[model samples]
Target chain A: MTDLLRVVDPGLYTTVQDLGRPHAISSGVPPGGAMDRFAHSAANLLVGNDIGAATLECTLIGPRLVAEAPCLVAVTGADCELLINARPAPMWSGIFLSTGDELHFGARRSGARMHIAVSGGVAADRWLGSLSTNVIAGRGGMHGRPLMSGDVIAAVAERSGPGVSGRELDPHLRPDYSNHTLGVIAGPHMKRLDADGRAALLGSTFHVSRDADRMGYRLDGATLRAAGDELLSFGLVAGALQVPGGGQPILLMADHQTAGGYPVVAVVVSASMAIAAQLVPGDEVRFEETTIEAALRVRRERRAALDSLRS
Target chain B: MPPPRSTTRVRIHPLGDTALLAELGTRLDTALNTRAIALAAALKKRRDVRQAVAGYATVTVHFDPDQTTHEALGSAIKRLATKRPPMEEPGRLHRIPVVYDGPDLESVAGALGLQPQAVAEIHTRPIYRVFLVGFVPGWAYLGPLPEELAMPRRDVPRTLVPAGSVAIAGRQTGIYPLATPGGWHLIGRTSVKLFLPDSDPPSLFRAGDRVKFFGVRP
Candidate 1:
């Protein structure tokens, strides 16, 4: 069986993603890939692909899939009403689609990101060992951009036992992306802010702006004053909550640029990133301060839970 | 010889269940940055550590939630931060060829009361160091442009700044790795590819590296 699926309708922001580009920031490559890397991995595992196999990442809306051959596919993350050949398709269940079968994903009413995994994985070229799309540089994925209407994606033809049965994300772990209360740790420049600035960060509610993207989420909320004088440009991380002169906090995300100079007030932990990924424009989010030790402990527990899913 | 062991201030915070934030103080000269890089590398060496997010003067260590706790990781990191050994080697350095003819070149020259050639000469006088890479992929923020050449970013960022377009802001010079919207004063362009996914290294430069600019034509 040839490993390819013709794209009939590329959804709003569909891109091929695996883990992401790692250890290349110095050369100026942002670690670009799925905003929801955890779900991306889970979907790939459910479909029996290697842990880091290339999978199609759909956000909000999903694209139409036309199977060119017999294949096994599974959808996870946000719930989406899926249909095959106009028949309702069960989510989180690995199902077989024959040649000429068409899969359709409609507008998403809930959840921010959805992952679709095909048996044998999506047949795509790997750049730096990933098929994820990086739009800013226009490289990787199906031609280094979102899948548009009329694009074709090949899958790694299945040649063995039936794919693993699908599974659901832990109910407790089900992220509340719509209304996220992200817990933040103090940033390097957190001390620069006066008492009022510190109070502003922990006290006010911030709205995710429409400008939010894989690069960074520009927030609109109370102005967080710097603790001290101006800071020279410095390194920045994915979760670094930087407040520019405007006082708005820009939460960096996957595909974020490598460095920044803004005064950072906080950094979100990995456990909360899944929830962070689900945030859409106009969503309300608040930052709760926590000690670094508490954050790491939470991350350790979450990792164990993910491992248990396979066993 | 190693410089005197200077006092480095670092703040520890929580990102979530999987990561810890290590914010280095403003005086993150060479010694403090070395300590930060070593800690980040050590964290990356762990099987459970997923990613390490480092900002200008901070590093956030991301781990698998099952294997480690935020408290445990933070404790481990703080211990390492305490007078740890300096990092071995810094990152690689790169020389980029650019054409010093950006849209904002003239205005920038006028702001400094010098000709565009003089502006370019002043800008290229020093081999700028890579402070960090952010705002976009492969877009390195090379710093401390000659004080005279310092200028503010465009009041209104252009809808599109072609890839490889070189620009400058107050005390900083950089190149646009790809075509996207930007506000930096455009002074020139470069054909040298700064980012390539298919390549083994992928990016033309990384953080902690030094960059020198040479004028190139279309």
Candidate 2:
């Protein structure tokens, strides 16, 4: 292991993440990981690392760091301006950093989160077989919390030889963050919602409220009236759209609780989860009903696209 | 009298493209919870399943869409749901002590039209079963709360509830494993820690476990 970067300014809620602890969900642990999986994998591939390798998930603003040693790095997602020693650098491409070179992020042009991957992957404390951080439980990653100033992030391995840089992802393959419509499949409890509530769910536009984070995004839209009967708490997954007593729907995200009692009206499909992950507060979003067959087909297409990038 | 055999038919529904929920039943009966636990255990053994989580009356099976389709897994679940595995032994039982001096204790007693001591006595009467372990890390949902003590959750939830707080809501009671926001009615506090992050399982209780609480001097 080698020390790679020392954080100078820990931007808004940065944490180390990989694919996350999917197996630990049965124990009430949320599958905490990079919100935007596509960007995370793209960043890792750009740096010639495994797609599941740990990367820094920067929220909103990006961190300022100084290189501790020579390393290859890449940044993807959230159109943030990458800077190397005050000089603007291109994103979605691998860049070689020399020892003591300062790396900074300027204004974000779009999206909400960015993934930065080093060639050897970020080294972090693992919990339940994952390097991803679960901030709520305070387990895994760097002390199981957000990155702080002065924290030295290390790489799992050093580059064996002179590393290649200028590896760029095709712009056409990138996800479009500007798209507001997310495809969703009917949830198990769709019948719980009244007829009007069901209509409003698919027809109306909702705005992402300020209460948005990795846990979930609360959407403000038409009041959805459902049968008043209380629901038995059941296992929940990221992308489940739950409607509570207040009528506003909440879209569960990467760090959502494992189980909940609120009735889920619909679940955002796997293909559109990346789109939901990039949404910021005040972003207008609408849901389009889709079939499970279509959802699976889209997911397969996405996997194929990522696989092509791998070769 | 021996308990009547459970005849609950399993209903499977797609949670999304990647997972399916097998609803054994809607009510919080012990039989339904036990069946849910059994179904989850069976699903966990399958190669296609990534994780099988048992809830109050449901088992959510997550799988890779590329490896298996929802229909394929759903039929397998249905087949497995019908075959009752040899009845397993009951889960381990834990006896916990609680100090009945919570701030909401008197209010809860008043709402139930009973003295606070009676409320404590009733709370300690039954050996509750853990129907699920969720909502937060190491938090267990133990239920079948005596109908007399059944109360709705607080209108205004506490911003921060302390760990080891023994609380009740609806027909269930649970101990807060970590300090978090809660809506349950706090009736007592326990000294035992429910969450052990460093441990292998990290939780003191799991689905199908039994818990019995007794009052202790403050």
Candidate 3:
């Protein structure tokens, strides 16, 4: 392994994440990974790394790092200004940094999380076959927690020769983090919601409440009245919109619990997950009902876009 | 007594493009749970499936969208369900020792109109089934809690329920593997660690395991 970068200033809640441990979910482990998978993969691709390569997922704020060795790096997700050696640098494209060069982030423009990928991927402790951090379980990633000052980040493999840089993802391929409307499919418990509740789900405009985090986004909107009877607890997936007795709806996210008891009214489609990840507290969001075929088609389209970048 | 054979028809619904939630039944019957667990295990072997998690009476199969579609997976699940896979051998049994000294012991007994000792006696009577393990890492939801001991969850959940605190809520009993906010009525504590991150199969309990709780002096 080659030491690549040193965390000079750990930003707010920065952790190493990749594609995540999907198989571990049966063991009650949450599928904790990069909230914005598209950006995470794009950043990895820009750095000539595999889509599943571990990268830094910075929340709200970004980190300041000093290069320990020559490495290629790329940043994606969140409209944050990048600075290299105190000079402005462009995002969505690969850049090379020499030893002793510093990287910094300035001014959050849009979105909540930013992903940074380095050549050869960031090497860290892995748990359940993943480097993604599950903070609740206190395992995986860097000791199951976010980065701290003075922490040394190493590359999984050493750069053998001069690495390629300046690879850029087409602007059209980038997701619109600004999009507020999300496509959703009706959940099994949709009937539990009263007619008004069902109508509100499609007609209402909700705002992301302050309680938003990796676990879920509690939305502040119309009071949805669902049946009071408690449903049997069941396995929950990210993007499930669960409405509790309180009438408020919560959108489950990447770090959500393995199972839940609340009635899930609808689930956001896979294609809209990146947009959902970019949402911050107080962001306005609306839901639109869509068919299964439409949801799958959009997801396929998104995957095709990513695949296009691969070739 | 072993749970009766599940006679309910299975229903499949779309969780999303990537997953399908199959409901075997509504109530928390052991028979339904067993079938769900069996179905989940069977589905996990499929090349198209990423993971299949069993709930009380449901199995949520997460699949690779590129490899399979909802209709295709739905039919596969139906075909598997029709076979009615025989219940496998009962999982490992755990006889956990617990000291029945908890903050809610008296209150829970009072609510049930029974003595604290009587409540503990009823709580330990049956060999509870581990229906599912979830809500958090290593946290197993066990029961069909005895009808006599059935008590509603506390109206106001505690801000922090200590790890290893054995608690009961509705028809289920569980031990908190981590200190977290909870609403269950805590009636005992266990020395056994349910969560061991470094160990393979980190959780001490798995779905379909058998658990028997016995009272012990502090």
Against the true structure, what is every candidate's RMSD? Answer: 4.1, 2.0, 2.2
Candidate 2, superposed: residue stretches over 4 Å from native: A160-162, B1-8
lDDT of 2 by residue, A1-311 (tens): 99999999999989999999888777788888889998898888877788999999999999999999989998988887899999999998889999999988988887899899998899999898899998877889998999999999999877532367987887777766788899988898899887888889999999999999999999988988667679899999899999888888999999999999998889999888999988999999999999999988888776776766565
TM-score of chain A taken by itself, candidate 3: 0.96
| Candidate 2, B1-218: lDDT as tens digits | 98554543778888888998898888877877888889899889888999999988899889988778988998888888888755867889999999998878999999999999998999999999988998899899998899999999999999999998999999999999999999999999999988888775778898889999999999
In candidate 2, position B181 carries an lDDT of 96
CAPRI band of model 3? medium
lDDT, candidate 1, at A288: 90
How well does chain A score by TM in each candidate?
0.90, 0.96, 0.96
Clashes per model (N, Cα, C within 3 A): 53, 0, 0
Candidate 3 structure quality by residue, lDDT tens digits, A1-311: 98999999999999999989877776677889999999998888877788888999999999999999889999999988899988899898889999999998999988999999998998988998899998887888888999999999999876532367887878787777788899999998999888888999999899999999988999998988778578898999999999988889999999888898999989999889999999999999999999888988887777777776565
Please give the distance, in angstroms, between residue A72's alpha carbon in candidate 3 and its true position after superposition.
Answer: 0.4
The global Cα lDDT (0 to 1) of model 2 is 0.89
| Candidate numbers sorted by DockQ from highest down | 2, 3, 1
Error of 1 at A102 (Å): 2.7
Worst 10 residues of 3 chain A by lDDT: A157-166
What local lDDT score does residue A270 receive in model 3, on the 0 to 100 scale?
Answer: 88
